[model samples]
Target: MPLNEDLPRGDAEYLSQSCFQFHEVPGSKSVTARALFLAAAARGTTVLRMPLVSDDSLGFAEGLAALGYRLEREPDRWTVEGRVRGPAAEEASVFCRDGATTARFLPVLAAAGRGVFRFDASAQMRRRPLGPLTRALRDLGVTLVHQEREDHHPLTVHADGIKGGHVTLDAGLSSQFLTALLLVGPLSEQGLTITVTDLVSAPYVDITVAMMERFGVRVQRDGNTFTVPAQPYTATDYTIEPDASTASYFLAAAALTGHRVTVPGLGSGSLQGDLRFAQVLARMGAHVALAEDHVTVTGAPGGRLAGITVNMRDISDTVPTLAAIAPFADGPVRIEDVYNTRIKECDRLEACAENLRALGVPVHIGRDWIEIHPSRPRPAHIACHDDHRIAMAFSITALRTPGITLDNPGCVKKTFPGFHRALNDLRTIWHRDQ
Candidate 1:
């Protein structure tokens, strides 16, 4: 498929005919990119198996190439030769196209170099906030000049050696800020100690720590204080896990439609924090069975759904999936503690509520929380707003009701490039062009 191809809506009924199955969903692109960068910074040969072969991962690889890392790609493995402490290509400009992980993590990667590197991206990536990361970098002695907005992307980062010291970061907006700093802290000449105030999405930080350990770095945490030891990342073979966030859609399908669905490659011992989504489904009256390597979700009998009120700060990525199935529940579903949704690919809270309202679902949106009330089913076409989560979430709503159409379904390529195909593997329904 071309980069800009439109993903047409196939018949929903056709989807249900085939059970969605994959031997292994590619490794976590987020983890792979971070690990690859760490390997590149360690000046050794790192062999990565099952690395995420998506645009985001590709962007990170490109950034590493620009930074002087030699990468050799095979059929299913990658070998990266790290440059350790060296200057990147003088004229290298990293074009991170709408990949926030690359855009955020690359700044810390570039902070250890001596040359100036320009970072630009697609319009959507430019709109995402880089203020927290930029501020943290500046505090560590990295000179960054904004080519446009003070807090946005398209900036020039002139590296002047990192003077790592104690710094306070506000993670109320996104956890990526803290993750960026944590990934690069050990490589700094002086090591790093960080204090976080009002941190949100702490689980993601835990992920960063776990990945850092996999690459041979130890991060000590005492309450709000994080200490990064001065050690090089070890070159080792690592595999990324299936994305728990992407699995939420299939899990939601089973909950809403009374279908039994099992998403393979994710297990009870998975690393992704979003795997807790099965517990949410269980709370909503779905029967959940967990085995060693798979989770099976069956909808409540007679469609007798229970309402839920929960705090989703840790698993905010599953919000869209949960919100899409909210109307099917017996009563109101209230989700709170996700204020960071406003700064994601889109303002998810408002976009979700507005898109639900467009389909005649009663939704009350607050600053950081949303309450959705179940009502009689009314079908309508939904605008995806070029947000992949919105597109996937609304499509789940169409499974039970008719007249639900999605505009610009192609937005799902941002994460699950085969989202529509996987969706088609679960259900059969009508799809009409508007």
Candidate 2:
């Protein structure tokens, strides 16, 4: 799967010949999804500013609409009329498409209302395990029955209402399980106390708690226990920051191509933990300037970096981004503690390892880790697994190696529909300067 011709070899490598300041990414999908849920649970209309318009975000809104929630979606703004009483429709069948947030969060939201809700997801989502969240809901007195598989999607919730109290949850596989329960905590008659035995993607839960606070609900935490009182969310106008995870690709591109890429609206004040990927690049010899309102990454000397071992337990979403450029480093890039990535749209760790090997790089995969070694990468067709992150990450590899095309480039629609066009725009600038 080489391109028609190689554009960046011999004399014309896409280098740091230009500065790409004000490189803007789309809105945060995490913040947008949480905002939609909070808005639906509030008592007044919530105005969302600059929310992401992607398949995942739109699917969440479509689910809301199916449940009889009213919304107005303009070009750059979305307004949701709040309803504390839960789904306006007595019953609904929701297709979660391929978003894990929609698949996981909606069922619990339905549990808080007095209705029987049937939730099903795409074949990809159905493969992921939902047992932990389902068990936690069952423990809360919410009756659920799996239709096609045990502890899987294609399930029905015979919801009378949630009289939530105390529940023990093991969220080691996914943090959405914990976040979903926490989101529905206020709807219970007696509130909720969630004792988490294990967890992953802890930063996502932090996002949930922070957004919940913005909607005027307080969640108390002591060690591993979280306590949320019976309360109603207060609706308000909320501005969503740009996606830090998506910004990682652009930042990594800047590092590998010896160019400068600055992202606006995601700076030091950003709520996302994935912004820390910039520090990871900085540690690998990139020049990173994180201002109060923006962040910029210029490539390292000669677009070269020294590889290092890093733990991505908190910011695992950027694992693929880093791995795509690992071959350019001087040493070995070892990423650790990212097991939860396996349960995503695809097994991301192995997928990264697979594509790296396809390009003639040395890569090793463990149960929860991957180590990529430096080598002269030979371009080949990349297998994208239809995961948006996987497709976008490998597109970075094509910049230097060239001739790298994905089988499913459109998978980026899950969060970033315009990813290829945006990356190509920057690529065009870099190529012109060269």
**Among all candidates shown, the one with the greatest lDDT:** 2
lDDT of 2 by residue, 369-417 (tens): 9999999789789999989999999899888987888899999999999
Candidate 1 — which pairs collide? 12-427, 12-428, 12-429, 13-428, 13-429, 15-424, 15-426, 15-427, 16-426, 16-427
Error of 2 at 424 (Å): 0.7
Per-model TM-score, in order, reads: 0.90, 0.95
Native RMSD of candidate 2 (Å):
6.5
What are the lDDT figures for the candidates, one per model?
0.77, 0.89
Clashing pairs in 2: 16-258
| Candidate 1's TM-score | 0.90
Per-residue error (Å), model 2, residue 371? 0.8
